[model samples]
Target: MDYLSRTKRQYWIVLFVCFLIYNALIVGLWLLLHSLGSHFHVANDIALLICSVFGLLLMIVFSSIISKYLIEPLKAIWQLILHISPSGVAVPAPNIDSLKTGRELVANLAMQVYQLTAVAGQYGTKAADSELNNNFVANKLPLPLFILDSGETIIYANIAASDYIGTPVKDLTGKNFYMVMDMSFPSESTLDKWLKDVKANTATASMSWERVRLNVLDNHPTRLFDLAAFYNKDNPQNYETMLVLFDHTKQYSQDDQAVSFVALSVHELRTPLTLLRGYIEAFEEELGNEMNPDLKDFMQKMGATAQQLNAFVNNILNVARVDNDQLQLSLHEEKWDSIVESAITNIALRAKVRGIKLESHIEPGLPTVGVDRLSIYEVLNNLIDNAIKYSNDSKVIKIDAHLTHEGMIETTVQDFGVGISPNIMSNLFTKFYRDHRNRSQIGGTGLGLYLSKAIVSAHGGNIWVRSTLGQGSIFGFTLKPYTMLAEEIKNSDNKDIVRGAHGWIKNHSLYRR
Candidate 1:
């Protein structure tokens, strides 16, 4: 930094000296003009005007000369700047001998530049040697390693990476890391998401994650591994974003199987939940006209709680199915109002329990949508349940359904709650991601939005969120109208399923596919 300041100071000093000389010349011209005015008996006003014009022309010409001889020469002092002469740029031959002192200053500045270049060259050599040594060690390591750019595009991959990915490094290079590695993690923060966060937040940092599932792009066997990511370091050009993986499949597979067994055991809780729901339904039926407002609210709360728990159990099972490729959506024609009403009914009680009102409005005459009723029901359940949980002091949650101009049913659930922060919005729908601030205060498994996103996407629809801090959030999703889906099926290849889809984005989610 100081080098730039010193070069700049020398540059200005040259300009200042030339300026002083130019001023003296101007003063000499004024005196010469006064002498002519007196000797030729010309008007003093005319003499002054003539001097002013001459002075302007001289100033312009002088500026051109100084810029060419001095400015461009001095610019070489800082070679790192582009669009200008670099360190090796040739200074004009036959130095400006008329300005001997200026010529010497230029020589001094050039000598300093040469010294700077030599020092930089020595440093570059050392950095190169260090990087070569690091690369040698890295290639010998058992961990699968990859270097990616800011967009997660793989630039280099080691031999272990090729073995792990089931492809040669040459073939994997230049592909998007995410596309090449068809994998997922059970953790809140993923390796890719953490890479982005680190790039934005820090200069030098690394993180390690365990139990990262690695499913190679090709039809290769999936494996579990521990992962590490490094982003934006003061290293060689290609080492900016690097990732390493340690195989842990054999170790984690048994643990995963154990968890699955425990989950199957927990599934038995549904028997008690079924009987509990039956008792609540009996209460609702028997109470008849004798129940007061408070008793009605109590019954509603109990019923909603039981239903909510049932949904969670199903969600866990369905998520497992999704991971195993067993989850499938069988879309059928259903009235928009029918789907909204069923979902709202299930979640309305939960809202009432939290003292929050659900205001639902479906536009009249909207076309029926093509969606799997059970799957979409869960999507709505997750969304509205989230709204109820986060609607801090707000009392009302609005559910709006309308036929978009593009012939899709757009459903939105809005809440005036302590909304999400902008910094954390990108990973809101990713698996197991909960805002740390609310993670302790709130009771959740961090899977609701992720499950909701997966269900909606599997239905060939798009889901997204829009929120402002303290102003609350709006979670919206769009489903194709049954008529349109039928028409498209009749006209085109079935492969082009999702057309003109606004999959998701920052605030608008307006991207089309």
Candidate 2:
């Protein structure tokens, strides 16, 4: 039967038993009183009156007990259920253990329900508090962040994002994401297409686009943002996209100024250095026979110093050009043998001074390469000069060239020196990167390898290095073998020949032995 029906039956049975017991006690008292009255020759009305008064008092006491133990506790439990809230359940102290069997069962059931509700309420409170804390932290972040819903609505935005758009976050929400931020692309169709793609690819955990332009609606300056969008794994269909913006304008401007300064300074310095070299050469030519041997040697040293300065200046200029994206190559068909021979001859004096032996092995019948002769010469000169400087006790450098399986000419500059460690090898060709271990021992601007890599890449080639820590190092680069089609293209009347994309060169895979 239901709890209510069972409780009603128990109540009826308890009342019936109480009635019977009260009647039995009253009857016994009457009987005893009657006998005492008879024995003492007292009035029967007095005995009967006393018994009735006592019976009424007994009924009152039993009713009070039932009200306190059963009625009050059950009423409080019912009130608690009715007033339940996330905060907690409200109920008076319960004496469920002292109650009769039927009332105690009802009381226990009510307590269990209250306990479950209290536990659930506690969990709900904790979850709400955690969400509030997360929101607080997100709003305090320095970078602008936005939470956009699936319909491209601005459901949430942080304080930085608000300041960026010159509006309060409250005003920003409930508005179309693109409308509030005023993000634009090179073309409207491009923006539409990108948005479509992002929405369609919901399976992607996170997506990012760098260097996106943000056009503020409140007349604030437009800025570049590295935007990232992510989904809530639990509720992907309804989750918001997290867009973060990282500013890089100041960094770009600083880099631009630095490159311009280097380019200008190098140009200004080259003219005077050229004049000094010319004068030194002229002096040596005029007074060679009359001057003492020691003086002639000094003049020749001055000449060599001037030449080294000129080369250093050239390197700085070229590096600046690369940074400014002004590097251009004049492609022409050049015999690889003659190019290598010329580079070796130019560095012969330096090699002799350093007591380093230079060796070259060119494959017979090697095809000519399409390249800018001057740029390739610079690459060879830089590699050989580095090899000489790091030759250590083993003063040997070798240059080898042969046709690769890909039909490209691969040239390697090998040096028996303190080979590069694994940690430093990865960053060897990065601009302005110098090995801390060798920086004190070697004098270099750290731009030679970087520039060489850039020039080689411009010719649609790849460059890499392989080295053992203490054994030796081999730096290699590939060049496209000259073909009739490439020759014809080079011979075309077009003076502006652009080969590769103008940007940083990614490291090619290291050529394994």
TM-score of each: 0.44, 0.45
lDDT of 2 by residue, 322-439 (tens): 8889898777666788788877877776776566789999999999788776787789888888888788888789999999998999999999898899988889999998878888
lDDT of each: 0.74, 0.74
In terms of lDDT, the best-performing candidate is: 1
**Judged by TM-score, which candidate is best?**
2
Residue 228 C-alpha lDDT in model 1: 81
Off by over 4 Å in 1: 1-263, 283-299, 487-513
